[model samples]
Target chain A: MGPATQRVAGPAGPPPEPKGAIMALTQASGTRTEPRRPSRKGTLTALLFLAPFFVLFFAFTVFPVLYSCYLSLFKDKAAGLGLGAVQKVFVGGENYLRALTDPAYTSSFGNIAVYCLIYIPVMIVLSLSIALLLDSAAAKARGFFRLAFYLPNIVPGLIAAVIWLYLYTPEISPIVDAVKASGGTWDLSSTLAAYFSISNITVWMHTGYNVILFYAALQAVPKEVLEAATVDGAGPFRTAVAIKARMIAGAVSVATLFTVVGAMQLFAEPLLLKTKATAITSTWTPNMFIYDAAFDKHDFGYAAASALTFAVLIGVMSWAVTKLGSKADQ
Target chain B: MRKIRKTHVVVAVAGALSAALLAGCSSGTAPAAQSTRSGPVEITFSSWLKGSKQVVEAFNASHPDIKVTFKEVASSKDNYPALTNQVKAGNAPDVVTVEYPHVSEMATQGVLQDISKPAGDFVKSKFDPAAQSLVTFGGATWGVPLDAGVLEFFYREDLFTKYGIEVPKTWAEYEAAAAKVATADPAVRLGSTVVGDSALMAALSWQNGAKWGGVDGDSWKIDVNSQASMDAMKVHQDLFDKKLVWADDDPVLQKKQAAGQMLSVISGAWYGAALRSSFPDQAGKWRVAPLPAPTSAPATAFYGGSTFGISKNSTKADAGVKFIEWMTTDPAAISARIGGTSSTFPINTEANAAAAKTFDKAFFGGQDIYANAAAGLKTVPSGWTWTPGTPTTFSKLADGGAQVKAGKATLSQILDQAQDATVADLKNRGISIK
Candidate 1:
């Protein structure tokens, strides 16, 4: 059992030393002998575990990113009327500076930021609240409810966008009919409507996964702590706020971090929604602009540079969230 | 002891999981390269052709020496990036579909091979000069023109008969027809309403004697606010305000246009398939007619058609050109594609000869729809460039138009906004548009 069990546990799983013993001893004595160093054999085994990830990370993520950084420095040169002696010439940060100042690019970023403001907190609260409800319920069908809540997350984001787009469209949408029958002309093509429309799609598609994550974290909170809170006359709401809430902050932080990163890569929803939201441009999001630059404009070098810069921006943002979230948790 | 064993099992399983996933990904891409290696000089061709699967299939079957595998690229918006990236990675397809708008940029990038000399026979007599002109970037023919999709006005013949309205021959007559149609049915629209400064409006403007780019051809000047185009826009705005057309661009608009809800639709020759598919009940009630002539001239305009170019990086350039020539010029192949696909008109004269005999005029109330299409095909004037910056520039114009429509801004302000945006977009792409 010891050998087989250790093998099944991930290479980065907890060490053999008892966690409780180590914590207690460290607190009391304030010092302890170091555990045995991982052997060369163990290091080799660890590399075996790591090799797969590094290969893919290098091939797909690292290479393209580095290549994009290299591409950003040049503009494809055409000799005359864009028809002759073609070559690539280094233009040195020209693409970057232009992208930064471009009205379309700036506006797209602004629209997405506004969309994130509406989306992130609402998604977190609703997802966490539903997860808590499922966790606290005494019904035996809790598993079924869990599955039901998480069902929408299984739908691919593109498919979800397409479905919502159809529903938002005025002519054939049943939703549109309802709006019209009630003496309301709900046009999702309007600026505000487009914002809400895209946000609603993100919430619908992702709320379920967030619920599952929160539920898993909620289940990990010790029953004894909750029982003690109950014995102390702390009601469900009080228990949730003071005790259960703090216990699930880890999951909440993780979910929030991911949502922020994902909001930056907003493409498929806006691209599909363009068919419905005539007001919504194909380059309404940053990723969509990158798409336009590469495909529509045929400026691959500039597009590649923008993508690399975007990747860096996302990395910084993700790190900021993780750092801020961890600080908030503390 | 049990805990330690359990942890080890978890570690092993996790390791195995990653190993399995890595293996899966590597194996998936490996086959793509391997299969092409063993094929009969495999020439990979890509197209954003959702409806031309039969043509692709015919090409694959009829040509055994140069096997052409057609990969359906879902959207034109995403296709070029994938193509350019593949080219950068030294894995470009042997031949790729380059839409008219991107032909200049692609040829400018030196990524498309020169098929000018080889494709001369196919280009000169077989295809229309205007259609051939689309693929001729940098004075060398880079691709074979596949279709000539001229924008024509399609209307409901039954609706015209039912309401006692004649087919419009002039812009004023078109306006009158729209008004009459609107008066007859509250639910019905005068014609399709356009959202944004789309290519359709540009075509209408061209028909109205406005050039999007400057006439000098060296500098940028938007004719977006040119009197003629502005007049066309004003007409659109009036129709939209009158509730004669839906002021949206949703798929539901296609459904509405298919039904009798729309009296007319201004679309390319390929719209016949859409009308048939969406409203089979109204199939025998539709008819094709020339675009209502503008005051300047009695003329029609072309809309959308993609061209096929051999990638400059392709190792099998000769084989790829052979496949393109075969696909574009073969009488049997084009006829099969046009008849099977059901709306696409072959650009080649030889192919048109084959396709003309096989038309289902029953779909258009026994009218010679192809002849109507062919008549307008001659009127398709060239010099309509679909610049790579067009999407970016026009989108900004659309955004500005949205603001103007909402009364948040003036049309003049929107025009200024669009001009600045278009110039900036061109500059960003490193194209010197003054």
Candidate 2:
């Protein structure tokens, strides 16, 4: 069967290829004696195989991104009490200027900056430590523990935030009750408290998934190197810190990169938490600013401009993270 | 070769899958064309109000020529985004539910159709002038009013009597009652701040003769932090400062009520039904009264209500307007809605008796809430027009309220901020502000 049929058949189908053969096949193709010429018939076949993906991708993704860019240049202008027909007036860079100048929109960047500072380090350290513990030889029930650690990631992020919202609310939370009984006060009414509460949720939901990623990278370390370390009188802690961690530095860097991007796109958690926490405003994050502009204010042009600006910011941040990550890996 | 044949099969499969996807995308547009030639003119109605399904069923069962398909959406805050998105995507329902405050904004944005030709006369003749003013803007009708949420005070009779606090008649007495409740028990509060509900805050301001903004000749005027508005807001701020009320949304407020920590709530007439559903255990203890006025003169304002508008993209505007008319004015539709325990005060004067008859007053301890609502409705000051930047105004006000709650700012400062932010937003949107 062709690759399409195999994919459609899913898990019930026979293996598409032996796991190890993929590596050998790539090597074989790379070391061909002569470069094969692309025949017109072969090119036609390749295009036919790629047609569906290109069509769906262009329809859903590329067009919307381009259309939003176009929409960002023009705004709807109404006259005479705004009950008459509206006109789309093109004003280049004006929307972007407005978004940049608005204090609420600019402050949202500060909110996410603080959020990333707390969320990223805590997530990386906690997940990496857990990965090390699970990878150690002394750990029992490795398979069960790995699955147990990964379970929280399986719950949708919005659902996870909702569950955490209940746990954070003062009226219904058992946590708050316990704290009060112990002569302590738990309140999420401050901006700092909201930041930590949101960070706590992201860490809880994502740390487990990162653990699995780091653990898999740790498993791939060669046995001979680890045995050599043991022969050099390296204890469990030394081996874990010096050998396994060094071996999985690439995985850790990749996880950090992903976490940075995820932190910048914080919308749903804070949006839900804003109901309970008086400190969390409608424009608490970049995405929420776009949402409030578009839906609440009905200023789609400003929303589009803010969205594009936010996208460029995210792109620059991602590039910086990748550069830093690769430098750390080297 | 074998690979060539496999590629051919893959190409065929991909083509078929894409064809299926294309078919699925085209199907949404096909029904509108088919309905034009069909037996019944099928129209889609989107609403989030209670008893919408029963009202649609009742309409469909009675009418043979027109059929309505009801789609339930989230509350107005969430639904407006979805509605506007649908309008932009060219897949909007024929009838859409919009709140009174949002009508001006939606109509100005071209999300709703100007149904002045089809249903304006009916709206003018059937609905009162106050209701008519809310729907008609810039010499055109954009929607049909369903209910008028006249402000009322909901209190627990048992708690008020036990605390020896008479129902408040003026704002001064209300403050005294709040103080009395706090002195009697530190746990119980007399009322709530409703910190995030800008609508309630606006209603309070409106009751105290605060005209936030209105059209002045050609340009729009916005005065959100007017003296009257600040005076009304400061009362609540004082209560908040004294810790005499619980500051929370409805869900948390309901929890406080269940714990017997909150004793009363100042809300719209519709909240009477909501109180029953939310606190069914305290059914016999609750009572409805007119809202306390700032002066000896009794005055109130509309708080929470919705209207039906035909989407600008709908090809069935006539059918949609018919459905809206029936839903808003017909006794049968009123009965069906009230049967679901919706205590909405219908804006149609003729349908008020029908709705009042159908509503279960036993939930409010047999108190005649309709008479109180009618009294409250008579006192709603006129000449208060909603601006296109009202949604932004409310959101900013709510944010300001949050700041006040956090002790970073006061209510008066937030009012100024809300006013300045709304003016800036309007100017950004190319709307003229005076």
Candidate 3:
């Protein structure tokens, strides 16, 4: 994975690994922790297992991405509906500049900025509250409630967005009709309003998965520590927040990192809502904007340029998030 | 030791799975385009047209040598992008429908083959001159003119009569009627803009002599937010501000049209057919007229139409041309297309008249709606070409319009940004935008 990553910029390479080479070396040495170095035969066996993974990994993920990076550097020059042979010119940083200045590309990033602002903290808080409730003695039918909460997560992102789009639409949605009947508005007309409407779908679809993770982390907390806190006359709420939440800080930080990454790649929900919400253009997210450039616009060079620049942006963001998350762990 | 062995086995299994996937992916070879020893050579027609299969069936019933099949690219919104991808991948359908806005873009991007050698003479002598001008870019013929989506005024006869409004022949009169009708009834609307369709705005601007995008000498000229466009936008802004036209750009605007609450629309001839199907209850209440012009000049705009072309990757270019030749000029092909569920105004002059003959009077209260369309066809403004970045340009324009609807930006401000953005976008694509 490390070699494959070096070959192409991975959009997500593991948030905790500050420098991949150091991480790999430490792991290799620490795993066989002994006075003697690991045998050559042991290394050969590991290589045999890793070789196939590297081949597939490089062929699919690394090659296409690196090729995209390569393609971004060149420009296709042809004349008159391009009748003659295509002339390829290498214009090193020009495509990157074009993407940076492009209103369509830049505006899509703004849409993500709005999405991340509202979705992340709200989702984390909701999932944590639900997980604590389920872990507490007050909650009955724990298994059934957990299953019901986790059910929406199992639905594919595309299907879930489609289901929610129908529900968001005023003419079809009974919820929307009921709201309107009671003189309340569920307006998906304006851009900011539409963002909220679309953001609600992300929250509904993903909150359950986080709930399950938080619950699992709670289950792993030491029974003795929990009993000690309870025996000392700590109330359920205090024990849940102060003890259980603190114990699962590792899981919570990991979950937060993933949520930050997922929020940035938002495309399908807003894309499905395009017809229902007119403000949501095809270029509504960075990923969808890149998809249009490559496929719809057939400006592969421009699309590739945007993809590489986006990768760098994501890397920077993940780095910042990891730093912030790790400091809080202390 | 047991744990380490199990973990090693898991990694080994994962490695095997990925290796197998890689092998499976690389196994399939590219299909050879030409026939080896075939009785009938089949070609694919990729389009967004609804009932395209009927035309292919009619073509096959006559020409047994070259058979064509239909493959839908995407919905109208994503059709060009889908087509662009297929062409780039080298397996694009031989007979693909290139819409007017994408005609120049596709050609310049090298998706289309130069049809000048095979069907150039046939296209020039048979198709309308205006349609010819659109397909021929960079001094070479590129496509077979399938249809012309000439814009016309479709209004409700009963509403106009009830409001004491005569059929408007000029923009000033049209505005007056819209104001009068809206004032007469609070629930009623004059019309609605196609919120998702930038072509509708471009079509109106075309009528007002806005050279939104075109080729001149060797350089491309794209004037999306020019003074003429401002003139067109100004009129629409007036209508919208005064509540003369409903600001509802929803697909649900069809609901208003069905109920006869919306009085009129200035859309392509295809939109009239849509009324026949989508709003059958409004039958015998609607009528057609020439598009209201700014001056006394008889000018209309082109909105939605497809131009059939052979893909550059097709091995059977000769057979492809033969199919296109029949599809464009032949009477049988024209009738099948005109009768289809989502057909447009026929591009062939004679076909236009012939299709007009087949118009059902029951739908339009015995009004010859196609007759108005036929007359308007003569006035569809020409010399307006498209750029490769047209889809991006349209998206920007529509987004800006959405912003205006949200009251975040003024019409002039948004449009000025759109024009400059379009020039930059085209230039960045290595296109000559001067």
The C-alpha TM-scores of every prediction are 0.82, 0.91, 0.85
lDDT for each residue of candidate 1 in B197-235, tens digit (9 for 90 to 100): 456766776666655654235443444566766665666
| Whole-model lDDT per candidate | 0.71, 0.85, 0.77
**Highest TM-score model number:** 2
> Deviation in angstroms for A281 in model 1?
2.7
Scanning candidate 1 chain A in windows of ten residues, the lowest lDDT window is A1-10
Q: Tell me the TM-score for chain B of model 3.
A: 0.90
Query: Per-residue lDDT of A35-89 in model 2, one digit per residue for the tens?
Result: 6788767887788778868888976888679979999999998776777777999
Each prediction's RMSD over C-alphas, in Å, is 7.3, 5.2, 6.7
TM-score of chain A of each: 0.82, 0.86, 0.82
Please identify model 1 stretches exceeding 4 Å from their true place. Answer: A1-53, A135-140, A216-258, A328-330, B1-44, B48-69, B75-78, B120-122, B125-129, B213-228, B315-326, B393-420, B432-434
Instruction: Tell me the docking grade of candidate 1.
Output: incorrect
Ranking by TM-score: 2, 3, 1
Off by over 4 Å in 3: A1-55, A79-84, A100-110, A170-172, A175-191, A274-284, A315-330, B1-33, B36-38, B194-196, B338-343, B357-359
* Backbone N/Cα/C clashes per model: 23, 0, 3
Looking at model 2 chain B, which ten-residue stretch has the lowest summed lDDT?
B25-34
- Candidate 2 accuracy as TM-score: 0.91
What's candidate 2's DockQ score? 0.41
Could you list the chain B TM-scores for each candidate? 0.82, 0.92, 0.90
